[model samples]
Target: MLKWILFALCIVGIYFFFFKKPKTIHEKKEHKKDSIMLECATCGTYVSSDEAIIQDGKYYCSKECAQC
Candidate 1:
């Protein structure tokens, strides 16, 4: 009975140590970005694409520049 219990334990230990797959839970990946800059057509200044005004297919830093 003792030998059977010891053998069973050894087998269980080996199976657990060797056969089990490691946790693959990856951490949430952080994203990256640098805002794209577009040059204003009238002022020749660079503005972030998100905030810049688009007019006549040209980028402008502000509404005043866009009207130019």
Candidate 2:
């Protein structure tokens, strides 16, 4: 039983190491998109670049902040 468990684990590890799908370019870009940090121009709140609004070369966390 122990040997079978070890073998199963090894198989699983090998499968993950060799056959696991790597992130595609689009997926990697999407991940990078979320990782970017931007500060709100008005309230100074930090937000993800993807969620921030850009206006007049400044980033805002929301529409209200952008208007301010």
Candidate no. 2 TM-score: 0.51
Candidate that scores best on lDDT: 1
Backbone clashes in model 1, listed as residue pairs: none
The sequence of per-residue lDDT tens digits that candidate 1 reaches over residues 37-68 is 99999989999988999988999999999887
Instruction: Give residue 66's error in model 1 in angstroms.
Output: 0.6
Candidate 2, residues 1-68, lDDT tens digits: the string is 99999999999999999877765646543344445889999999999887999999999999999998
Per-residue lDDT, model 1, residue 43, is: 86
Q: List the candidate 2 regions with Cα displacement exceeding 4 Å.
A: 1-34
TM-scores, all models, native as reference: 0.50, 0.51
The model with the greatest TM-score is 2
lDDT of 2: 0.87
lDDT of each model, Cα atoms only? 0.88, 0.87
